[model samples]
Target: MEFNSLGVLMIITIIILILFIMMKKIKNNDSDTSKKLFTAFEERMGLTCDVIDLKEEIYGIGLDRSSNTIIYLNFVNGVEQCIGLSEFKGVYVHRVEQNKRSFGKSKEITEFVFIKLLPKSDLAGQISLELFNHKWYPFSMEELELINKWKRIIEENLS
Candidate 1:
């Protein structure tokens, strides 16, 4: 009993489809996992920094959260501005939307997309886009420093 060409092709096609679906799921999960980790970082860091989540209410209450828009906070000077956290609530949310198209649907493949307003002047003098996941989009050093700083804050505060 030899294997038929159609049978072989069918097996190959099914395998490919399964693999593709699995890959998509994995990718989606990875990004969400990374976001989860980051979200924890945000919460642990407290209300000090603006937890801007585009998926949520991009437009926030101007009175406490942001006077103009929180998305613009990715400034060259970093997340820490003289604005102060206590006096400011925030215009951000808990979940941000995914703009990139990919295979996985529910995967979180390492928080890929990020935006920055400028470079961190104090840290290394200049911010490189690679401070991000080497994504095609440019991410300012200031944003990276803020993320790192918050991650550190979570480790120090929670741990």
Candidate 2:
């Protein structure tokens, strides 16, 4: 079998194209799953709310203006968990920082914003929600603001 430079280039290009298409398909599937989960949540809540953040099959945050509740939907290992909170023990925000050094390079600092849900019941453990950037980077200011606003609404309703 004789292969020329052009033939090798063509093969590489075809492989790249196929990989790209496959990635797009996978992303579309995740988006579809997210939409379905959101719809189900909305139906159960019986009120329309805007989705604040969706992390594919991981979790989602929504705010119901009519009921003044924060809807948290989480999917883990094929199990779906939903929490509708009009009242809670507390809402807390904190920052996490980590420093790491790799192969003689200077230390790198990574920060994350963690929004925690403290349920009133002793049976339920605290739940932490993380905010990320559009590119899936950690700690997004917009998400933080949205979460804070929802927390305030919930607190006011409880009072």
Candidate 3:
């Protein structure tokens, strides 16, 4: 009878340990997913992010969780641009491979603002665009439009 009781006790202890381990795994997974989601939002907004300095990780400033999402604030050229993940729904995301024209004479390369990773429409906060010229040309309307579109999406998501 004593042997049976010990076997039952051992089984109960094992079950409890298993349950505890599963719970811990779940908590860790949720946190990892949130981190990845935030990073992707930064990419979508098309933040005027350029790798100014190389380091052990991205973002020199301390990161924080904002009212809505996480923000990795970086100060470049005397301003903070918060970088984080945004969302999209009911749309198909695709990846593609491209090759440039075989000859240098055939293809045109242009330098302009890339806005895919920026927040929509001053939505994150009221931020003014500071002019930074490249290759002797001032900021163009095309770049401004991209920035505006990102701002709009960010505003919509925040609301």
Candidate 4:
């Protein structure tokens, strides 16, 4: 078979286009599933989320600005939690790290990451929304980024 430069270029472009479309579909599906999970939580609790951030296919966080409510869901663990901003003092990211020694080499590794909502009342314990856990999920900078973003949003709403 004989191939020209233009033909090769066209074939490469088509493959790239197909890959892009497939990625888009996967992203959309993730978003759709996150929305559905959030919606079900809202209905069950009689609340609505005005803003949502889908961190992954199995988890997301949302806020109901009018009600000052924070909603979270983790499908992987079947965990769901909600808290009102008025009841919390502030929100911040909590990360745990430990040094491990392997073959005389030490490296720091993150154990878990959480977005914690500190309540105003001493009687109320901190509400932790797990963003990542080394034992359960692979480590990714994206998870850290998402937790920080939510921390800022929650803090802004608190203030």
Candidate 5:
């Protein structure tokens, strides 16, 4: 077999081009999936508003302006829960440590955030919702800010 420098360069270029195209396709697919889920949620809730899609977590937050309600859609559990300011008590940031085995002999420690929900009723127990599982949600900082903003809004409305 006879090989030249130009041949090797061409092969590398082709591989890079293929990788670029594949990445683009994956990004588009994610966007499409998020859109479909958002539409279905809006239809089920019978109201439309800006919906924040935590695509990695398979859930979303939809604020119903007319009713002043916060709708939480959990795709994994197939549950739609709504919390009105009247019944909402408070929210806090909760953290948990997760340990995982990595690189055959190394252990990795990871921290995760959960927005704990509390209701005004004493009979109601606290609920902890995990922010994400496997991959880090890109908009996690923004999501946390949104949650805090909603909490303030709820408190104001309650009073």
Candidate 6:
């Protein structure tokens, strides 16, 4: 009986070790993707990123302080957009939420979130960087915080 218990403990330890290693590898892969995307973006745009946020695997945002340029990239879809701070008249956090009632409880569900950049000129189109969408990704508080952070950063640079 004691021998069987000891063997079980060993098995559990090994399983835990394997899980830890797998988690580490997954983290490393994310870092690698961010690095690659940053490098490619910098090279293609010919601008160095002074700050970058890549918490979301599907999307990334970067800023070039010297030139006051903000770049938004969609990694999975291969979509990229960049704009100068001077061109935008307003920066806003656009959030779409719906109230749902279930089980005698009310809850608000976020359907979409974005950082919208309104251009100064009416003819020029406004730009929106996607942070989260209920259809594609689950809502996250971190994304909310990130969108707010970037809004502040862009507003500061605009000033």
Off by over 4 Å in 6: 135-138
lDDT of 5 by residue, 50-98 (tens): 5354543376666666766666666666666665656657777665656
Model 6, residue 83: distance off in Å is 1.5
Q: Score each candidate by Cα lDDT.
A: 0.36, 0.66, 0.42, 0.84, 0.64, 0.85
Top candidate on lDDT is 6
Q: Could you give the candidate ranking by TM-score, starting with the highest?
A: 6, 4, 5, 2, 1, 3
- Give the winner by TM-score: 6
Shift of residue 92 alpha carbon in model 2, Å: 2.6
Instruction: Give one digit per residue, the lDDT tens place, for model 2 in 58-102.
Output: 667676656666666655434343456644677777566666768
Q: After superposition, how far is residue 48 of candidate 1 from its true place, in Å?
A: 8.8
Per-residue lDDT of 133 in model 3: 26
Error (Å) of candidate 6 at residue 16 is 2.4
Give me candidate 6's TM-score against the actual structure: 0.89
The clash numbers for all candidates, in the given order, read 16, 0, 22, 0, 0, 0
lDDT tens digits, residue span 1-159, model 6: 999999999999999999999999998898788778866977799889889887546777899998899888887777788778999889998889999999999999999888888989999988888778787778887777778899899999984
RMSD of each: 14.6, 5.2, 16.7, 3.7, 4.8, 1.8
Q: Please provide, for model 1 over 1-159, each residue's C-alpha lDDT reduced to its tens digit, 9 standing for 90 to 100.
A: 256988999999999999999999997776565445444444443432344321111111111143222222222223322222232222111222355656755633344433222322334222111123323344455645655553333223221
Q: Please report, as a residue range, the 10-residue window in candidate 4 with the lowest summed lDDT.
A: 51-60
Runs off by more than 4 Å, candidate 3: 47-159
**TM-score of each prediction:** 0.37, 0.62, 0.33, 0.75, 0.67, 0.89
**Root-mean-square deviation of Cα positions for candidate 3 versus the true structure, in angstroms:** 16.7
